[model samples]
Target: MSNEAMQVRALRGRVVTPDHIIDDGAVVLSGSHIAWVGTADQAARAGFGDAVEQAQTAPEGGYLLPGLVDVHCHGGGGESFPNAETAEQAMVSVLEHRRFGTTSLVASCVTAAPDVLRARTRVLAGLCEDGELAGIHFEGPFVSVERCGAQDPTYIIDPDAALTRELIELGGGHVVTMTIAPEKPGITGDDGVNAALIEGGALPSFGHT
Candidate 1:
């Protein structure tokens, strides 16, 4: 079948596939679903496990699952979203984690105005579509100033569904996750704005107020 239909197998070193360890585990992948998993002997009977026993030159080590998926990381390497500012410059931050095994990455942005956010999303969305990026995450611009972490308080605003929808659309499908403080004390003008954003294809995650 298609590679996408194939399973995830990490026989030798480290593989942390989506979850815990496999140890000397044998992983059977079918499509995106794990068809089977057990010991080396069990996998040998069914076919597929650590080849350590079958090898003499390979590293004498335990079997690692698959790599990890960092859903909340900012930029890559020493580059950060706020520091990088622009999406183009932001890529350096993205590639930093790919080496160790970050298959997917979300380009997070600071609290900026609608136009700036749109511009950043436009670039990040393109990167994601081109396979260089995975998704875009907006952490602020809708957070509570009272509880703002390291983010700039000047960019904080009450959650607005209209802007949120626009931002997502601008990012294309590259925009998937959003960290919003739903309890923020704004959003007074529009009707059903919250529902529109929460339901309009964006995964809204509650953040600190």
Candidate 2:
């Protein structure tokens, strides 16, 4: 015989789902995911009176929102990802972002030497593997020097597919995204660098150009 299905629980608050917001509504949570979302009255009408058992309610004037994701944050709390002296320092930065309500974050590194970039990527990759970070974001070297805002223009270089692969490989498949100027040196139409990023399951974003 089949076992009893797990009971659904409700969280009463301002439920903000992907599509819409439900004020004074309830969110049904099944295990780790959102199972259902609607007004409390609607749930009761749908035969979920018992489902509201042991549910939580939000404080007055409070809202429940999905965890925020930041893709291009460089540093916070007196720590810089590109200048991270150690993994511990890097973690401090992550904590800072989290405190500001960033549930998911990618550690972005600025323009630097290949060796420096590789080292930083490896450190950030470890954080990703540990589930503390989303992934690493390389935001320089392949960007335009003229458009380089805070990045060190001296460290900027043309896009090199092999070098890109080196960084990606060093990250052990944790490179989530990299900003590239399609007009940067070594990046022609159908540049191999873009191909390498795509092949390694990393997104090639356009910026700084």
Please name the candidate that would achieve the greatest TM-score relative to the true structure.
Answer: 2
Question: How many Å off is the CA of 88 in candidate 2?
Answer: 2.9
- Once fitted onto the true fold, the runs of candidate 1 whose alpha carbons sit more than 4 angstroms away are 1-44, 47-63, 83-88, 185-193
Cα lDDT, all candidates: 0.66, 0.84
TM-score of 1: 0.69
Ten consecutive residues with minimal summed lDDT in candidate 1?
49-58
lDDT of 2 by residue, 1-209 (tens): 22224556778888787888888787777666677777877887766666665568888987778778998888899989999968999989899989767999989998899989988988888888999888888987889888999889999987899999899999989898888998766664455778889988999898998
Structural RMSD, model 1: 4.5
In candidate 1, residue 56 scores what lDDT? Answer: 26
Candidate 1 lDDT: 0.66
Q: Candidate 1 on 31-90: residue-level lDDT in tens?
A: 667666555556656655443344222155644444547677677677776556565677
Residue 10's lDDT within candidate 1 is 29
